[model samples]
Target: MRLFGRKNGEDDSAERIAEFWRWWEGARPGLDAKVAAGGRDSLASLAETLAPAVSALHSGLVCEVAPGRNAAHALVVTAAGDAELRSLAHRWALAAPPADLVWEFHPSRQANPQAADLTLRAGDYEFGVGKLVLGLRVPRGAPRVDVSAYHPIFSELDDDTRLDAALLALDSVLGEDDVARWVGEITAVTFQPIDAVPAVHLPAVVADLASEFDGEQWVALEGKTARGRPLIAAARFPLRPVDHPLYDQHLAVTLPYAGRDGDKLPTGASVEALRDFEERLTRVAGDWVLAAHLSAEGHRIFHLYADPAGEVRRQVEELAATWGEGKARVDVAGDPAWSAVAAFIS
Candidate 1:
């Protein structure tokens, strides 16, 4: 049997395919007349013969295949004779199959005007393809034709496969020269990880706190500032002598202060006070404060992994005296041992 308009004994060469497209391009205006004169059998014959090739090309274009249908359908969006083509397609669809093959010839002007006069651009073709969309744009001048392939049978395939299929489809429709140009104009897509807050370490204070607690553990804390910058710190807590080293420590602190409106710490004097506080704690307590934050509530919270109980009390007293009383609070895990251990360590 003949396939894709090829005669049983006809030459099946790439050159022949090119010739067919060229002929179709030139003779497209008269196709409706030809079909009308050819009658139902001729249309069915055309559909049957073109089905495989059209389906293949569509698969390549969309990187997908329609499910449950033996025939392939295409939607050609163009700036040429769109209304006439749509009417012709509608008239054709009214007939019963095997002549009832589905195809659409649309004018981009009536649909997406942006795509109507689109030049050769490189980006993802979000439309046209049903699911396995290509990430390349075919170069076409104004008053040009753009093809879209659709299939209902869905399977999730990788990007590379879909792209390859798209290129192959382009090769069939626009031929190798056009496909090569498209490939040259193609752009790549990339992904990035979300930004993270920087981490802080305070070994000396951690060691001092470890000495007071039966056992001690440390953790990293992360949050965001009002302006969306990262806020990170380290935390320490007490563990019982019999507790496993890996056991979770409940004692911790969350730092910095923000305004009620989710604003960062005041830019001037408040900033100075915060820096001075960090420096003082480092000097007196051996850098136990991993990090600090100014909360939206106008409170400066300090995150500490280790605090000798007595030293923490003394630091709090001194900080209140300097920065104003009740302006800050130290958060620790609520355990009697955590409080008791702090008492003895300081």
Candidate 2:
């Protein structure tokens, strides 16, 4: 189910990246002249040529030309908001020519909230970004925002086209990376929901909310497992998986307790012991996040995320080996999306 173009768990080829950069440097000059002169034929040729060069890096990657912040035109090679492909776009950007009077490079679409007249077309419908309104809902105890959008023109298109248009407009304003990182679920609404706000104001709203998620706050929940067993779970209240993208490894430390009470929950003494172990483990597991934990079935599981480069997994393994509280089973794997413990927050 992986949607990104890089080979699963494999590094993208360096020589391939060099080849594309080599091609771009040679082709950029002529393309720049014709593009600046507004030559339609040259624009067509540039698009066709650029597609393969970018695809050579990753099939899922996309590129385009736009007015630039650093120069007259920007070559924006982007991940189109797919978080997994961001690194590919970044690698391409790193190899790009220096920004000059006519050229610049962008790894992702930069936000342009002041494009007051920004308009987009999809299917058979066209709408102004300013005319769009958004319905935002942050689940009472959850970490993300779910958005519903409305535009007068949505009435003219089918559901699929309507959603696509809404997304494209949002992506243009917020930039693809932020949209992918911060936004959860987005759908098109037929009518403005209860407290819809103007799309132009969305940038500020998202910024304010993002700042809150960046804070330190944690919450715990008690429930029953699907098998009707008692369970206790805890995690950072506003758990943002993309907050630290480099921490792509998932580590699960399972400690079976002989101290479970009648209800299959931890006894008082076991709870204190588990907490101390977590504090010590966390201190040594540099750049690690205890994403979530589950206490059920006579065992307490500590779900974690960490940067492999920090030797976090090795450090944690060392701690687990010397533990006196039953044999600790530590499992580690690649999960950049942090899907393993998402249920605790969701």
Candidate 3:
């Protein structure tokens, strides 16, 4: 389908009206004089057939066609998912009869015309449309047409019933300049809370955690040995790599912080630097994207995990090196005792 600019470009409304008139006048050529005199039916068999074909394709697309919009020479379909739609388009192209044609697909969102031309330039045809778009190609004499389509997220359906329903809803779009299809899946919410005990080693619970939280690893927030003081150990796990619904809940309720009310202790520059570095690390790591909570009961310590990406790591390391190697313990984990613990660590 080719859509002409009705507003930004030339006078498209006038162009459309002219094209329609030209097509109407040329409906029949060299008609029998006697039949013409008898006033033959205006509708022709070829026109009727072509109309159905056009309608079939148009019924599946997802774009809106205005009165002066460009004419549709092909079909456009909109599907529930971005990726799924692209995949289907590819399959259809592979099964189509060969012809001299150009086909392609883009895996990106729609672009504004001010930034780049949304026109698809392939061989002799130039299609200028907008939105997340894809195209297909069929070489002359090839048995199958080539397909190109865009990929989107959260629209995949492996089940036949769901797929069928989604296709039915999007059956109107034969082709579009802007089309967004399914891309990926949304992972289920999961949480793993590690148990910490003072002066004792906790049992490993990897298997249990895996079953409960879809293969998540659970580390005991405990010390290396039973004889050693049960210090707060770090429990690291991979987040779901996307926005979490419970993020605000986790932040407002979980961050262990109690600013000085009246009993204020002068914090040295070292402490200030550590907090600043921690905040930076949190921002880079996307630590705030997921919901996590620290319970009031566990032997807990709050520290920022350094971002392994830049000078932050080097700065943190250099700061640590300022003290002797063995003397860095008090700073790294803080004193493994109650008095040195932050008030929020309660």
Query: Judged by lDDT, which candidate is best?
Result: 2
| TM-scores for all predictions | 0.23, 0.80, 0.19
Give the per-residue lDDT of model 1 (tens digit) for 1-346: 2223444854343334444355445544454443555665655554544444433322222111111122333333221212212222222223212312433332111212122122221233322322222222223321112223221211233455444444433433333322222223332122211221110111222233334444444544566756675544334432121121111123232233332233443455656656676677666553243422223345555534333323554555455456542344444442312332332111
Writing each residue's lDDT as its tens digit, candidate 3 over 182-252 gives: 11121211121122111001011222222343444434343333444333333334322111211211112
Model 2 misplaced stretches (Cα beyond 4 Å): 1-44, 71-77, 81-107, 124-126, 137-145, 181-184, 190-196, 211-214
For model 2, how does the per-residue alpha-carbon lDDT over 1-346 read when each residue is reduced to its tens digit? 2222355657654566777777777877777777866865776677777887788777888888767886877888887766666555665687776789888998887777465488677896668888888988877645567899999889888998998888888878787667776677999988888889887777787888778767677787899988999999888766765466566678999987767888889897788888888888768837888888889988888888886667888888888887676898999987766778767543
Shift of residue 343 alpha carbon in model 3, Å:
23
Model 1 off-target regions past 4 Å?
Answer: 1-264, 286-294, 307-310, 332-346
Q: How many residue pairs clash (N, CA or C atoms closer than 3 angstroms) in each of the candidate models, in the order given?
A: 25, 0, 38
Instruction: Please say which candidate is ahead in TM-score: 1 or 2.
Output: 2
> Candidate 3, which segments miss by more than 4 Å at Cα?
1-307, 320-346
- As a TM-score, model 3 comes out at 0.19
Evaluate model 1: give its lDDT: 0.34
Question: Whose TM-score is greatest here?
Answer: 2
Cα miss at 54, model 1 (Å)? 77
